[model samples]
Target: MRPSLTPVPLGVEPMTRSILFEGLFVHGLPRNEAFEAELRQAGFDRGDLLPQYPLRLFRQCMDIACRHFYPGLPVEEGRRKLGHHFVQGFTRTVLGGAVAVGMPLIGPVRFLKKFPEHLRFDTSPILVQAVEVGERSFRMEFRTGVGLSPHFLRGMLEEGLRMTRVNPTLRVVRHSPISFDLHITW
Candidate 1:
């Protein structure tokens, strides 16, 4: 993920103890491992959350855990706990938006309100911006540096889809001029 927030000035490390990274920032992400364990114990059915879960949904789940117990986790702590998972999930949402150009809820940002973990305008490498697109679709055009591998990207996508009701036809576009896409299909 591309890091948007520059590290704080010298001796500001303490302020960023919670940053997490998937492929980018790898700094203070959020976490709720204890809550996850409880979820398994409580037999939280995560019915369709098979191999993976959506990043946004994951955020929702994480928030639930935090509210229920891990209140100590601040913004950075939450980001660290979420780490790459959070970034990866949001990345999918970013890419999904471009492809959803024809769909109203394509970006589905409203959905994120309930699932409050994904960062807004993160500098993480997973998402980047170009002037033409402005911040409209940064990751959609970003492809200069190393991009995520298909194998890993697919997994992240699958996980993201599971978290929400993704339109299956929204193919995972990889290895194109742009790295990713959330296109429409019949």
Candidate 2:
């Protein structure tokens, strides 16, 4: 099913750091002038990125990445691909360098266990609840004002797990305008 992209309540806005954009463009799609130009049109100039930005701008950039790199895929699939790129790029950034070095050493289970803590690196207002369901598996629930689609989170989690050298399977059991539940196993 397609995840909802409902807007957050009025007067409430979610925010993130510029490192995310840098992750996607500089680390994810490095040296792609076309992608850079597209972002420049969308009011995000990679040359002069902000330290923090609202979720709306982040969504716009994600849209651009989806269109630029995965146009042939379905919308959900495209966002998933973008999510993978986000993590891949994010880990390459100075902010995420620690994750790159540490995730593999700790492995997937530990990573998922510490996922909520890792998310603290972002300034976005989000609440995460993680529960271990079985060996090598866990369920994570997220509540956020940011309207991020489930596919993106799924892809991001999947990629993060893969970085630890384990093949992962993820599914969204429930989704709402403000919250979602993701189950993952490797």
TM-score of 1: 0.26
Worst 10 residues of 2 by lDDT: 1-10
lDDT of 1 by residue, 97-158 (tens): 45334334434333322222332223222442322222222122223222233333333333
**Native-vs-model 2 lDDT?**
0.80
Task: Give the runs in model 2 whose Cα sits over 4 Å from its true position.
Answer: 1-12, 121-123
Instruction: Provide TM-scores for the models.
Output: 0.26, 0.86
Quick one: RMSD of model 1? Answer: 14.2
Give Cα-based local distance difference scores for all models. 0.35, 0.80
